[model samples]
Target: MVNVYVLVTSVSPLTSFLHDISVVMTIQHPRGQPVKLRDFLLQHLDPAASHQALRQVKQVISKVLQAAAASTNKKLRTISRCVLCFQLLTFTLLFSSSVTPVVVQVDTQLNVSGLSNDAFDQQITKDLILEDTLHFLLPPLSHLSSHTHLSSEREGSQYGGCTGTLGISLSEDEFLLLLHFQLLMKTSSAFQPLYPSVSSSSSLPRSLSDLPDLLTQIEGFYKLKTNRSCRTDEPPRQQPALSSSQDEGLCVDPHLRQIYTDPPLILTPPFHPLVKEYRTEVTFDTMTVRIRPEPVSSACRIHLDEHRGPRMANYPVGLGNSKISILVMDGSHPEPVIMSIYTVHVYRESRPSLPMFGYHVMCSFVQDCSLLVQPGRPCGLQPHSGSQSQRNACSSGHVSGRWVVPCLSCSDNRTCDWREVSWQPDGCYHPIVDHPLLQDCMKDRKLLFIGDSTNRGMMYFLMERVNSTLEDWGKAHDTLVYRNLNRGRTLVSYSYYPQFWLEKKQRPTFRQALQQLLNRSQPLVNSNQTVLVVGGVQWLNTNHLRTVSEVLDSESLSNILVVVKSLGMGFHLPVDGIRSLSLTEIQDLYRENDDIVTTAKHHGYEVIDTFSITMGRYKEFLQGRCACHFHEVTQLYLSANEALPVVRAAGLTADVLLCFLRWRSFGPQNLPVTERPPQTRTEQRELYIHSAANQPCQTRSRTRGLNPQPIVLEDQ
Candidate 1:
């Protein structure tokens, strides 16, 4: 087989599908080994060599080839996935037979890292009219053994659910995305018929089609299984499965905080086709789990047995205990999950269970009298320590004398003396002037926050400090990013609940989200310099938090700086609000958070101790003002007897963040001691809520209600 080196150079992008990219190629092959294009390309497509242009080109080519072959090579099967990311990056149709094998031995070095969005996309259409050209890019559908089905049409409408979208223009960008998405999912299986069939006779299908119903069917199956109490193999009591159309889609609101717990139990000893696995088979007994919330608490029974395994140790779950899940940490893993169990095991019912990698956790209920603490594998503890580094607020030259700043708003100017406060010099300092060093450090970087509103606040807070001039603040929808195009190309952005589930389709799995994030970021950003924060502001319940953390505990988690903050801000419970968690419930929530933090840290994530800071400030900022959205913080009053802007809140936090950015870097360094509590502890005592006993445990609730909705949290 001959090997060829081709350089792709740019053409009119809006005109053509890809700009040609150049790379000096050196193809090294064991002599006489069959050199398929897929093998040849995989062996040579180096990011270092091609400025990452070869990435998309490689995916399209590889998927087309890999799907064509029925071989389930473990390497290939394990090649997980991401959202359908199709950018007209670079490259075009591939025909292995088309390549005239010739090798030109040459060595040259050029960096293409700056070349953004240069790669091959089979279905990325620039013009709606040019959809036909995209068809040429993909291998013909004849390559795949099966074709994907499009959802049936609604009366007089091309599109269906999220019904308003029907008759939407095909030329719209969303339509293109919807189309590409359909193609990606259809193709997602293995590499066969990645795309639906289209005719040479017509340019566009006479009728519009959306994602195949099969995708929703899978989601429906999982939804029906979430939170089910115990079941061993033999599909949980025959529930009616819905067709794709009837299934509730994955596109729940980004702000929608939901937790689905499906403790799926599988039997090791194979069961006969007709044999029924019963609750009694494993020496299991049932009992109720009583949570404080009157209605969120269900009469769900737990199944426990005393059988011990080589790795798993049984713990007796005391009745009516606050804890909701069993976190089984196998000692063999360095910082990885042995397995986990949640409410699903006790529910014996199902509803869209939280999306998790079922394969990662082997869950079965075992009865023990008390929780067992495994050595070196404590169930609920942050494993890491804080950095010794500290930058004092008193040290900064920007602060020379006593500065009085405005705090939260005051009504009727009551209690004048109580309103005036002195700036505390004990913590980190935010320098209003002379941050050139800090600017240079963060320059040319893309900082993104993807959780709920607190993360949105985080993005807003960071933007206030780094860039002097803000471009497009709060204007963009779906993704909110601060653009500093001229300086460092430093883009700071926030995505409110970053679209886990598309509008009507099923929510994407974690791997898919990771892929989309990676695709968006500049290729060079990795664990050393960036942090991917999850779980700070949404889905505080055990099931949801576990789901989010489980997703965070991914292969991508290792390569990137992963920071898992507990859900909700501890301080935000409205002092007199109609809805609020009792002190006990809050403590319980924090305890749940600690368990998640331990699991996350063991799986390689830096846990931020927000719970400590929020608890301490609960009497201050949280009760200080009943603000729901940390939309923008303003110092309402300068000081007693002085009318001015409230700069204290921002001033204090700015300094704290300043210390974080300067000394407590996200890459490899632990948080600075000043930012981290002296010690990290996970306890339910409200008095020590602010104790930093655990450097990595922080749970600041950010859910909408001051507490959970009093409404019965039964299966919808």
Candidate 2:
């Protein structure tokens, strides 16, 4: 009952042609299921399938090759080459084998459209015919009972003892099958277009051009659902408190649900996670009011209006709450003018609320009548801190012609006057000003005052103050030559160069003066030995001023008072003076002054604001005169004496003396008692030098020449 059948199916006409080629080969097999030729040959012939299978395989291979020619992947091409080589080898082995005989027949016509050469097709056709002839004459053999027989025979042969049974070798078939299977696998791996679910009606596209319409519709639906859920799940917001006034009532009605839903309201979250609350109580002359929710937050804005001519507004009461306190005073009397207070709280998105808290009280007297309350002045806003027990002593009472009543404590309390109360809190106080460098200078160095008569006045005032404290200190002296007066240690020196112009009068330039001074005293003025204070020219009209810039251009004025003033002083003449002058003159004066200040700064000089200091102190005395006369000088000296304490406090310590000549008396009684100046020239000059003289100036060699020093006598 040896029966065999080969069934083949084809999707294209190419597969049918390949099947026709396979029918030309003849094979015999005992098969319940189809018998493979490889198994039959292993039992009879030494090799696997007969060569006739190669012809049919070639036909099948042609179709696969045609498919592979269309493929872009290099791996697919490699697979086709490997499959063709295996088929050729199988045919050679089958033709050499003397095992099972087989018939060859064509299964289908080959489709080689994708193949590049016709020579390959002709070679396959010749090979297939030759393999069929050998397969038909091969002898049949029985299956061996012992596995050793098959192993020994296979060891002597090159076919590796693999059986070509069941009409075809399973391994060989598997190789061919895998090749085609791989093509199927690759084809399956490609991306394919997806179709929308039929159940969705909204998936329809709006227009052929609107490719994303479906996605947009889905997203819109999702957003709508999310927003609705958010709205429904949110907690109701608590409303702020309102006054009992009918006008301030809420406008929402019971039947207004549709109105509420028509347009949803959006609210911003609080800036910080934690909620802050505060309370503030305000007291006017005759009224006291407390605002709700203190520390006004951005969520609430408060507006205040006063009936009086002057406008008033509510200020934040605390650090983080949305509350503001308002107090209105009665402005009817000349006593303390009070104003009417109206308070409104505006929510970020809602109408303003009425006054949450308020009250009226009558007061005996009003306080803080001015628009701008002066610092350190008494006002009712000050808290009573004299004693905890005395806080309740004051009582409120009604006064005639006053409608509102004041708090009992605020009305009768004398401490309620804000001007009398100090603004310093219970434990807080102003810091004392201290700089290490200033302290060191005051304690260790001798400062030189080296300007004009004004500088002399500053020196005198400083010296007087110092001498008053340290009785052993000597008085200041003025002379044309520099003199060191101390006998042993340098106590202090006061020298004067009294030329109306420190530089040559004809040249009138800072460069010339700096050069002359440096040439004469560069060693003394250098950083190590001295600190100089020099400024003068308040007396020079616009016509005679020599700016520091002109001087620096001519000579180096490094480390000098002239350089300091030129750099640091920001002084300009009155606007009226500049306007009155011609443009050319104005430009020249401006440029010269600017250059002087700049040069002074370049030299690292500390430009003391002498002009401002002098102007401010003796503004009245110098009101009408370009130069200070004897009387004015005397007044200046007196004024400097009075200002000595302030100067010391300012930390100016210098040794150089200042001198001013005037006809007024050095005695206190010389000037009118009522109109007496604040300081005299001698006193001011002495104070200035003493303040600067931390150490006394040592006496140096006196000049032994015809020009003798003028003797300076102390006032008895």
**Residue 205 lDDT in candidate 2:** 53
Q: Which predicted model would earn the best lDDT?
A: 1
- Over 653-674, each residue of candidate 2 has an lDDT whose tens digit, in order, gives 1211211010011222332242
Regions more than 4 Å wrong, model 1: 1-434, 475-477, 482-486, 498-514, 538-557, 570-579, 619-658, 664-716
Report the alpha-carbon TM-score of model 2 versus the true structure.
Answer: 0.22
lDDT of each model, Cα atoms only? 0.32, 0.26
TM-score (all chains, Cα) for each model: 0.31, 0.22
Which residue window of length 10 is worst by lDDT in model 1?
7-16
Identify the candidate with maximal TM-score. 1
Give lDDT tens digits, candidate 1, residues 80-163.
Answer: 422222333222232333232222222221222222232211111122112322332353565333432332123114433244
Error of 1 at 278 (Å): 65
